[model samples]
Target: MKKPLQKSKIPSNKVFVIKELREAYLDKYWHSHEEYQLNVILKGRGTRYIGDHMKPFKEGDLVLTGPNLPHVWRCDNAYFDPESRLETHDIVIYFPESFLGKDSLQKDEFEEIRKLLARADRGLEIKGHTNKVVIKMMKELVHRQGGASIIGLLEILNVLAHSTELEPITQIDYKNNYTAHEKDKISEILEYVLHNFKNKITLKEVAELANMSESAFSRYFKARVNKSFSDFLGDVRISNARKLLQDEDLNISQVCYESGFPTISNFNKQFKDRIGKTPMAYKKDVIDSL
Candidate 1:
C-alpha cells in the first residue's frame, strides 16, 4: 500500500472502498483523483479546504465531494506540537461516479441520486437529520461484508439524494485547473492563508508568493475560485470568528478583532453577509443547539 499521504488510487476491480482512519493528521498535500468521496470527521478539528472554499471542520462534520475537487482536512497546529497528544478519526468512502454501472444511474429509480451526484460537484456538507442517520449507517457499514456493504452505501446515498440538508461548499461553477505544478502552487497559497488568515492579508502579497504580477494573479485566482480575493478572505475570517464566538470568554468585539476584522461594525456586516446572521445571533444558535 502506498503511504496514506500520497494521492490514493482505488483498485479498479472494487466498486468502492471504505476506511476508518485514526491518525495524527490528514494528507499534508492537496491533490485529487477520479473517485468521488464522502468524508466524516468522527473525532478531529481542522481547517477544511475544498476548491475555493476554506472553513473550519470538527467532529461530526460530514462532507461529500465530487471527483477531482481538490480537498484536504488539515489538522490544527496543536496536532503538530511534539508534546501534544492528539489524533483524528475519519470515516471515508470512495466510489467512482459511475460505480453502479453507467446505465444504473440513468434509470428512473436513480434520478434523484443522479442529481445529487451533480450537486456534489461543488461538494456538500451533510447536516440535520440526514447527517444523523447517514453517519449511523456509515458506522455500521465499516464492519459489513460483500452485499451488505453495497446495501449500506445505497442507504446512505438514498438519504443524501432526498435530504434538503445538503449545504454546497463552493461556488456552483468552480472548476479545478488541474496540473501537477498548478496543484502545488494552489496548495502553497492555501497553506499560507491557513496560517496567516488571523492577520490582514493582501492580494499583492499572495501574488508575490505565486510569483505572478498582481493583475495576472487576480485574473488567475478569480478564474478558478469564482470569487474575488477579498470575498474569499472575508469567508475565511468570518468562519474563524464564528468558531471563536463559541467560547463565552470571547465577546463579539473580541471575536471580531481576533478573527482579523478591524472593527465590530465591519465584522457584524461581513458575518451577516456571509453567514446570514449577526455574530451574536450565530452564537445564540450554537448555544440553543446544545
Candidate 2:
C-alpha cells in the first residue's frame, strides 16, 4: 500500500465518513484512528496492508479494522479512469467501541461481537455467504442516516460475529504503531522492494532509499513491518511465485528463477515454509483444481 501523505482527523462526535475515492491518489501512510473502521471495497482491485499483513484486494471485499490498527487500501491505475468517471466507491463506517452500548458489552449475546472486534486488531476479511449479506447491508447503510446507520452497523457485526469463514488478515501479535513519518518511510521501502523483488536487493540499496544507515534501516524496518528485511523480501518473492505458479507454462524451476530465488533448493524451502507446500505439490494442486 502507498503511504498516506496527509492525516485525516475525525471529530469525536462524528461517527464515520463515507469516502468515494475516484482519483489515483495514495490514501496516506498507515495510521490508526480512535474509532473502529469497517470498509467495503465497492469497486477496483489492488493491495491492502492491514497491520503487518499485506495481500491483494478485489471488488466487494469487506474488512473490519480495530481502532489503532494501521491500514491502507491502494487502488490500481484503472481505478482512476477519467473516461469512465467511475470513482472507487468505498463505504467506510467509523465508530468508537462505546457505540455498542454499555449493556450490550456486558451481555453474553454480544460475546461474538466483542471477540470479533478484539480479533480485528489484526484485521478481518469478510468472505463467503457472510460477505454477500454484509456487502448488501453496507450498501443499504450508505443511503441511511442516524438510527438506521446504527442498526445497519449492528446487523453487519452480528453477521460477522457468527461467521465461521471469516479470515484474519494478520497474526494476533502484529504491531501497528506507525508515526506518520515512519509510515511514509516504510511505504517507500515496500514500494521499492515490490518493484525490484524479481532481482537481487541489497541492504545498501534499501537503506539508501530510506536515506538511513544500514543499521538504522534494519532496526526501523523490523520495527515497522514486524519482520527482518530479508524475510520481508522473501515473502514478497514467494507471493509472486504463487501467482506465477498458477500459469502452467511456468515450471517449478522457471518459477524459482523468475521469482528471484538464489537457488532451486532455497526456493523450494521458502515456498513450503511460507505456503505450507512444496512447489511441485502446489502446482499439482492448482492444476488438479482447474
Candidate 3:
C-alpha cells in the first residue's frame, strides 16, 4: 500500500500558524504530519482516531496531538450528503518543536512546556475552564500580529502546561513508532474496521488488507495497543451499541445484531462486562433520562 503520510510545511516567514477550517466535513484521511497540532471543534460531531485510541467527538472538543502521531476525525454520515446543510468548523494551531527557537525548550522557564509536549505524545483532550481559556487565546491569535501572536501562543501553552484538566487520549503505554509504513498499515486497518464494524469481520480479512500474515498482524496489534484485535473490535462494537441503545425503537436483540454481534447472549455479556450494565438496563437508563 502507498504511504499516506501528510507532508505539511509552515512558511519560512512564520514561526507557527493559526487558522480556521470550514468544510463539508473534517478531513477523513488518516495521516500524520511533522508538527504538533492543537485543535478546537467549533461545530460538528464525529469519531476521532489517534495513535491506538478511538473515541467519539463533538462540538467544543479540544485536543492536542504530538508530531507524527497518526490521527483523523471522521465526521458523521449526515455531513457527507450533498443535499445536507451540515458543515464543520474548527480552530487549529500548528507548531513545530522549534517554533520558539531551536534550543528554546532547554531553558529553565520552559520545563513545564517541555513536559506538556511530552504528555502530548499520547494526544490530550483539554477540558473544563482551561479548554475555554486556550480557545480564547487561539481566537485572539487569529487577529494578532508579530510578537503579539507569539505571546498569545505562549500564553495558551502556559495555561495548558499548568492545568490539571487534561485527559490523555491514548493508552498510557501507547508506543510512538510512527514510521510511514506503520501509519499506512494502521490507517488501513482503522478504515476497514470502522466502515465494516456493523458486519462480520475476520482476522484473515484484515490481515490480508494490511498485507501481513494473520499471526504477524496479531502480534503487531497486541504489542502496540496491549489488547488483541478481537478485544478492540468488541470495544468498538460496544461503544456503537451504546449509541444505538438510545433509540427507543431498537430493542436489545436488534441492537446486538446491528452492532455486529452474532448472538444476544454474547452481546449481553460483553456489554455488562465493559459497560457495567445489562443491555436492557442500559436501555432503560437512557429511557429514564429522557
Candidate 4:
C-alpha cells in the first residue's frame, strides 16, 4: 500500500491562479475547491482528470469545471525541456456561484448564463470560436484588478452563455459529497492513482493510500465517486488510449502498450465498450476528419 498525497486548498475569494509550469510533473493532489474553475492552456500538452473522466489535453484547450470537481493537469514531457522556457502558462479562473448574484439567474438578462452553469456540472469544453472568445477574456482577466476583475468575469460568463459550441466533458454526476475530510481522502486516492496508473494498481494499494482496508476502501470509493475502482481505472486507460490513437505515428500496438493495457484484444474490447468504436476505427475517424 502506498501513502496518500496532501491536499491543496484555494481561497474562496480568489478568482483564478495564473501560473507557469516549467517541468513535467504532477501539479497537485486530486482535490476540489468551492469555486467554479475555468482553465485555459496557453502552451504544452498533457492529460486532464475531471471527476471520473481522464483525457489528453493540449494547447488552446479551455475547460470550465463546476464547483468541487476533482481534477489535475498532467503536463507532457516536453515541458521539462531546459531550453524551452515558455513555462507552460495556464490561466485559471475560479469563482463562487454567488459571484453572479443570487438573483442574477432569476432575471432575464442572466437566465442563459445560469442555465449554462447548470450544464457545467459535468464539466464543459469551449471550442472553436467560443474558445477563442474565452481565451481573449482570460487574458483580460489576468490584467484587470480590483472590481474590474468581477466585471470581466461576468462578461466572460455572458459570452459563454451565448456560445453554442460548449461540449460536456463527461456524463457522470458532478454532485460531490460536501465535507472537508471526504474531499481530502478523495484527493489523496486520486493522486495515488495518477502517479501509479501506468503500473499495476490493486485494491489493496489504493486502500492503503486511503488508509483503509480493501473492503472499506471499496465502499468508501463507491460512495464518494459513484463508481468502482476498476471502472475508474479502465476509463483512465481508454481516455489515454484515445489520445495516443490520434497520433498516427504510433501504431495500434504501441498505443495499447503506452496506455497501460497489457494486451491488444483487451484494449480493443474496453475501448469499443466504453467509447462505442473500435480503436482502429476511432483513429481512422480522427485522421480522416483532420
Candidate 4's C-alpha runs over 4 A off are 1-26, 76-87, 100-108, 145-149, 170-172
The lDDT for every candidate, in the order shown, is 0.84, 0.76, 0.86, 0.76
Candidate 4: tens digits of C-alpha lDDT, residues 201-239 = 889888887889899889888876778999888877887
Question: Which regions of candidate 2 are displaced past 4 Å?
Answer: 1-6, 9-13, 20-29, 75-89, 100-111, 247-266, 287-290
Q: How far is 289's C-alpha from truth in model 3 (Å)? A: 7.7
lDDT of model 2, residue 275: 82
* Top candidate by lDDT: 3
- Kindly give the stretch of ten consecutive residues in candidate 3 with the minimal lDDT sum: 1-10
> Which candidate leads in TM-score?
1
Candidate 3, residues 1-290, lDDT tens digits: the string is 56456768578888998988899998777887889999999898767878778776778889999988878887766688879999999998999999988999989999999999989999999999998888888877889989988999899999999999999998887777766666667777876787788899999998898788999999998876567999989887887788788889998888999889999999999999988999999999989998
Query: What CA root-mean-square deviation does each model show from the true structure?
Result: 2.9, 4.0, 2.7, 3.8
Counting clashing residue pairs in each candidate, in order, gives: 0, 4, 0, 1
**Looking at candidate 3, what is the lDDT of residue 110?**
99
Candidate 3 Cα deviation (angstroms), residue 48: 1.4
